[model samples]
Target: MVEIEYKNARVKLGDPDLVYEPAEDSFLLADAALEDTESGMRILEVGTGSGFVSAVLRANFENVRIIATEINPHAARCAKKNGVEVLRTDLFRGIKPRSPEARFDLILFNPPYLPTSEEEKVPVWLNYAFDGGASGRETLERFFAEVRAYLRPGGRILVLISSITGVEAVQEKMEGLGFDVDIAGRTKVSFEELVVVRGKLS
Candidate 1:
């Protein structure tokens, strides 16, 4: 187990197969979520690997109910340990409380946005956190497709994306989905430009 300090919280993460470490993408997503959410906002974290950001949100905001979903068993356990009310489901599959009151005001995801070849992909359980398929939009496309079902009337999404994933293509996809997309934040690393995209239904 490794204990890492992220933003305003210290989180303990276990095996990588279970939980993703706190990396640049994680921090970027967390910062954007914090900026977008307020006390009354209802939030849902799509892939709460280590539960760090959800914990931070719960700590920083009041009267805001935050729930997280994780597909990996280990990650789910880790999230539970950190006080996240976790749902073990693949994306939004099998989620409970599908009522309107369960609709989220904002959703956050730091999905696996890195482009990877077939050979480069790892095990299913481990790769879901980082393998973004040949174009890096594999998981992203799925998220954008399924997200509309869970969003409240004015609800939106803040997701961490990358230049490597074809930024223009992502934007085009968002437009196709009837969402007005904008860059919430971005940081350029050595080669890839990591971006946090905020999208609302148009």
Candidate 2:
């Protein structure tokens, strides 16, 4: 297991080779989410690799309930080790709110936004962390389709998208889905800019 500290929180990465390690995109999303997080809020983090973001929030907020989902078993284990409540399941597959009251106040996702070709794919579980299919929006499209159902009325969503993944396209898609969308934060990386897209129920 590997441990790293961020925003005063210590996170562990169990089997980094198998799980997605926290990187620039991860830190960007965490900082953006922290700007909007409030005490006593219920938050759900989809695809919480290594639980870095959620762990940061947990350490910084009091009375905040955070739950995370991960498709990778290794990631789920790593998140659990980092003191996050995580479920090992595909996006939203295992989360079924018993009532509207159980819905989350905020939802966050840092999806795999790389435009990966079949030839570029790896033969390990880590592929799920960086494989966004040919368009780099396949998994994100899936998330947009189902996320609203799990969010409470007026709840917010914060998602990270790279310029290579078509940030404007993502913002337009979210708007078309009945959200008031805007760019929350952005940072330029080596080859592309990472942006945090904030969407609110309209």
Candidate 3:
């Protein structure tokens, strides 16, 4: 296990080669989450790779319930080791709310937003971390389709997307889904600007 510290939180990565390592995007999302989260809120994090972002949230919040989902087995284990409650399943597949109150107050996702083609695909679990299927919004699109059912009334969503992933397009999609969407955070990296899209149920 590889351990690293960020924002006063320590995270363990099971296998660096197999699990997605925390990078600039991860830290950016964590910062954004910290700003929006409150005490006693329920939060769900999708694809919690090294559990970095969720761990950061838990370390800083009081009475906050956080659950995470990861499709990669290695990543799921890594997140567990980092003290995150993680489900080993695809996005929202294993999560079913028993009632309206069971829904989350906030949902967070730092999806794989790389535009990758078939020929660039790797035949390993790591591919799930970065393969966004040609348009860099495939998994993101899937998440938007199912998120509303799991979110409470007036709940919020914080998602990280890159400039190359089509930020405006993502905002438009969220608006169409009945979310009052806006850019909550932004940072320019080497080649792309990462944006945190915040959406409130409307």
Candidate 4:
């Protein structure tokens, strides 16, 4: 069990073997993105660790409905306890709109942007939440490839990438995918530089 305080909520995380470190960057990125959405926005939160972002969004938006996805089963269960519409998914698999007509106005993620290193002590659940493959961009690439299918016309996506993961490389990747991207916010942490990238689908 791990405990984290985020967005004024004490969230308990359960994972028998993995040590949970709350990603402050993830929570901050979600807050920044929420400012840009309207009151009734439909939101999708990817990687809903402990449901911090979902809880915050629920509090702020009166008519908002959040669809949260987690790769870890334990995390999904934890998020469900927080009143989130939680689904266990490896990335975006197993999640789709209630109807083909349903789509999200805002899609958010604070993905595992830490580049994998040989020296790091990685546990099973942490790997699902922290490993971004050899270059630390593999998961981002996969998300970008699949995002359009779930987005409403002119919908926006906000995500966090760190300097350790090569922030500029992520921007270039988004551009090559034809998204109009911008830096929504930035913060410096003890170990990494956190930035929120907002991409609008054309």
**What TM-score does each of the candidates earn?**
0.92, 0.97, 0.98, 0.87
Q: Please provide, for model 2 over 72-134, each residue's C-alpha lDDT reduced to its tens digit, 9 standing for 90 to 100.
A: 998898899989999999999979965777899999999999999999999888999999999
The C-alpha local distance difference test score for the whole of candidate 4 amounts to: 0.78
Cα lDDT listed for each candidate: 0.84, 0.93, 0.94, 0.78
- Worst lDDT window (10 residues) for model 1? 93-102
Candidate 3: tens digits of C-alpha lDDT, residues 44-151: 999999899999998898699999999999999889999999999999997996577889999999999999999999999999999999999999999999999999
Candidate 4: tens digits of C-alpha lDDT, residues 108-184: 98888878876673767767678888888888889988887888877888888898988888888888877899999
Residue-pair clashes, model 1 = 0
Candidate 3 stretches with Cα past 4 Å from truth are: none
Model 4 / residue 146 / CA error / Å: 0.4
Candidate 2 deviant stretches above 4 angstroms = none
Candidate 4: stretches off by over 4 Å: 1-10, 15-19, 97-101, 118-123
Model 4 lowest lDDT segment of ten: 14-23
Q: Which residue pairs come into collision in candidate 4?
A: none
Candidate number that wins on TM-score, 1 or 2: 2
How well is each residue in 65-141 modelled by candidate 1, as lDDT tens digits? 89888888888889898889999888888765366657898999888888899999877676888898998989888
Model 1, residue 84: C-alpha shift (Å)? 1.1
Judge candidate 3 at residue 159 and give its lDDT: 98
Model 2 TM-score, 2 decimals: 0.97
Where does candidate 1 clash, by residue pair?
Answer: none
**Predicted model with the maximum TM-score:** 3
